[model samples]
Target: MSTVEPTATKRFSFMDILKAPLLIAIALIIALLLLGEYLSPGFASGQQILRLLIVAALMGIVAAGQNLVILGGREGIDLSVGGVVSLAAIIAGNLMGGENSGIVLAILGCLAAGAIVGAINGIGVTLLRIPPLVMTLGMLGVLQGLLVVIRNGIPSGRAAPGLSQFVTQPVFLGLPGIIWLWIVIGLAMAFLLGRTMLGYRIYAIGSNEQAAFMAGMPVKTTRILLFVLSGMFAAIAGICLLGYTGSSFANVGEQYMLPSIIAVVFGGTALSGGKGGYTGTMAGATLLTVLQSILTTVNIDESGRQMVFGATLLLLMLFYGRGKALRA
Candidate 1:
């Protein structure tokens, strides 16, 4: 009977769940929200939380593309996302020109603009063997210069009235339409990662490029497409931003550049790639949003907040880079 006893299969425990990044991020968000409430009586009210969530949604959308690039591996990082965001906003503002009729055209124009820049980055990284950091950093400078040139004595464009309303006004169940849009994007990303052949290919290349190529996967194309998608996602963020602010400026996107990366990393998407998902990123974005709000409540200035964020990011980089897996 003892000899006939079956060996046990390893089962995940509650302790493992406690160590999971997504769960940790959620816990942090709750803790920070409570801290905010303690500091400011109305800080954690449902309306305020909704507003913060909308902001998180914007960051998450941009991080989605970052997710794809990092997942495709090879030290992939997009420093030019800020630049792309600014550029796309300017382009979108111009195309939309304060009219609803132009919304469709603006979306297409922004996507095209973003795709071109992404394609260039992809070619540089894969074909020319330029490092992702160097390539995107250089592109960022180029994009900034282009922004300066394009804005030469010209003011940024305005959002259509309908567009602005969709982003800022409550549309369904006391939530703005943008939040609903975020929901849709999140679902789409989850499906893409879990159910699509391309998603599997992305993980394959990200995990081991050489192995993926040997296995007959189109590694180069996948990587390139990842960057393109990243750019397009940035473009979407820019468009939403224009609607949020009702107008665009040359420097509007610069603020979001670093935050986008931080959000992705915080969301528990591995910096080393091949081992994370969007669910963690959404949580991470919310965590950052809540933390920043709490800091603001504590009277920390913008610079102080930036310093905290930098330190937090540094710690996270080390943690995820070294920890590798969710283990007790």
Candidate 2:
């Protein structure tokens, strides 16, 4: 008899790797929609869903930046992102003053402010070897103080009318322009992380920094650029938020910090670094927004809602944590 040869099993494709979490997210979303419909017949209507997407878009934008930072490895994170958002909104609002003509300057100002903060963060982390957490936290305090001094603890400015109208006005398919903006931004981010040399270097450094350095990667430059990109993304999010709200405030970005981190982690990014993508973060953002809607519909008290949020986050962490261990 002829000897039988054993064939090697094929490794899973990238899409296959993504499908697990993506499917779970979709299922969870559907379940939530059903529950919402049961609790309130109109809860799952198209309009309601679109509203949820709008809110998700806001969080998604900020979370995208956090996602990038976390993906860069070496204890990377940006605690000051919330502060950046707040300052960006304030700057944009004041510069625009509800005037269409001021939109250009407003945008430039927001980006500049974000870039400056990001540069400082990059310098501190890459050059000084400061822990990212400590650096960003200190920066956060500084920004909070700066904003207070700038505004005298009183927020004073209206969002640009043109910007506000653009974000709020429904366009094709009954979706606001902001949603399209989110989609474009999401696509751009996906391309950046998956299709560019920069993306490859980011993952390489994240996976093993010493190895990446030995392989001739500009480790410091790449890390610093990651911070810069993160800051820019945060600024864009802040501007969109101001447009959505038609105004800006000192604490406007406060609620987003934790949510951004949660969304990034829940989307399956490893806290230790490396091995994740924007797709998971987007799904996480959607899930969070939907959960918020459910909590509101059920009239859950703030304390109860917080408890549920914490519990849910813990479960997600454990779930993904197990997956990570298994892969190891």
Candidate 3:
């Protein structure tokens, strides 16, 4: 049997588009956008869509790291993303003190802190043979505790004026800085996954770890690098979140942990790993964000939304759990 791959041709028939996960995700995004507009007048306005896109951009940034780790195989995931994001935001807030002069240093500090946490996680998983789920989950708790110690159970600090402006004010093409940043990230991910040696090796490991190892790939190091990158991406999101909200809080990023994963899966990245890309994740993030907004517009309370998210994730996990058997 021959597989009609989506990428096999530049042109896709309607049936082919329907069968492609990435295309499905994009279609869902458009459908949801229109749905939102139907539910609330002006919801699909250019300005409103841009605003929602910024929110999706933040989620996409965080999911970017998750995408890579999952792509690296070995059940690799970063459950600690929310904690890393919260920690980075708090630390960046303190470092920035709302001053432009401190912006660069705050960014450096947050990225470094996130990278260290990621390095430890990578070492634990890659070298110590700790399961990715267990390792990242444990790190989440540690980071939460650390946040308390750092802020003494109180949320403090402010995003620099410049930072806030970047996130909220138009910078280029009438889009905020975060949108531009997200574009850069998406482009970079495409290049890394499509053109780089590291990208090929990552895909190789994900497809078959034992075979990759036999082929002399540095599997462990690549996995470690993926986690490190994940941490850094989460940190960047944290920084952007701080700017968007204009304040730093202990639990500011608490909401993103599962959503990041959801975005990755919804974007058509299989939780079982070995097949996915940032493009799908971007569409997933946008669709999720728009769907959430529509839900809110319809008066779904926070708890209700949480339930929906939880249920969605549960269903996906169950499906993926049987993926191999299904394929067989």
Candidate 4:
């Protein structure tokens, strides 16, 4: 008997995986204010870059969770992510009280609360026969309602003394601590996705779920696990928000949902699932943050900001969406 070689299928190169629209978005962002230097000198300064990092670090953490679920396939998307963040913050605030003594319990409580909420999302999608979009959206509203009820329209609890200091203070190297944290998260997630079998399964499932199931991948279990991990990441974001602001608020996580989705999508992760990485998501997050900073420095009003943001998203979808369709 002769041994035979296994044939390999063609895969997209890393650069090939990145679509043209993403490149355009990046270029547009870079040159958005080049023509206006006379009107606003030093518009893109080192200080501005640092501010972008600070904002991206906060938004990217939540995007990290969305990255995992979207990459896991099965029409998977978490609409409840913002809700989880908001509710977790509220829970942490209520449990932590104003006293420094309650800090440990509050942190633990936040983690548990996030996990529970994520589990509900997982169950609804996987076991209850609800589409992920519908299930997560419903949960989002429910979670928001609960947060309002719990906090009674007021933000509850001040963050722990040490956490507030840690987030706001520059590290020994003079960069904000949150930036360092984001770096660490990027590295860790990269390692996890590359080194573990779990990571392979996630990619496999996203690429082709029925085939993955036929290949004996633990489909449902993996979904639950992915959701749980997503919840954990969202909780961490809420915690970071609290530390950065020195207080917890009911609205803290409300702003995260779209940015998170946009970051992951813009990062080149397939919204339809499969074929993307933390590198893309991180870069996308950075670009979005920079765009916002530029807009603010130019004194774009609230309506203007919304208009630009929506327009950018629409362009990204038109271009990046093609790449995704091609991948499929």
Our model 1 lands, by Cα RMSD against the true structure, at 5.5
TM-score per candidate: 0.89, 0.91, 0.90, 0.86
Which residue segments of model 2 deviate by more than 4 Å?
1-18, 153-155, 323-328
Please list all clashing residue pairs in model 4, or write none if there are none. Answer: none
Candidate 3 lDDT over 54-108, as tens digits, reads 9999999999999999988888789999999999899889899989999999999
User: lDDT of candidate 2?
Assistant: 0.83
lDDT-based ranking, best first? 3, 2, 1, 4
For each candidate, the alpha-carbon lDDT, in order, equals 0.83, 0.83, 0.84, 0.76
Q: What is the lDDT of residue 143 in candidate 2?
A: 90
Q: What does each candidate score in C-alpha RMSD? A: 5.5, 5.0, 3.8, 4.3
Which lDDT tens digits does candidate 4 get at residues 135-212? 888988998888878887565877776667656777759887888888899888776676677877888787878888
* Top-scoring candidate (lDDT): 3
Looking at model 2, report the run of 10 residues with the lowest lDDT sum: 3-12
Residue 117 lDDT in model 3? 89
| Candidate achieving higher lDDT, 1 or 4 | 1
Local error of candidate 2 at residue 258 (angstroms): 1.6
User: Which portions of model 1 show Cα errors greater than 4 Å?
Assistant: 1-19, 300-328
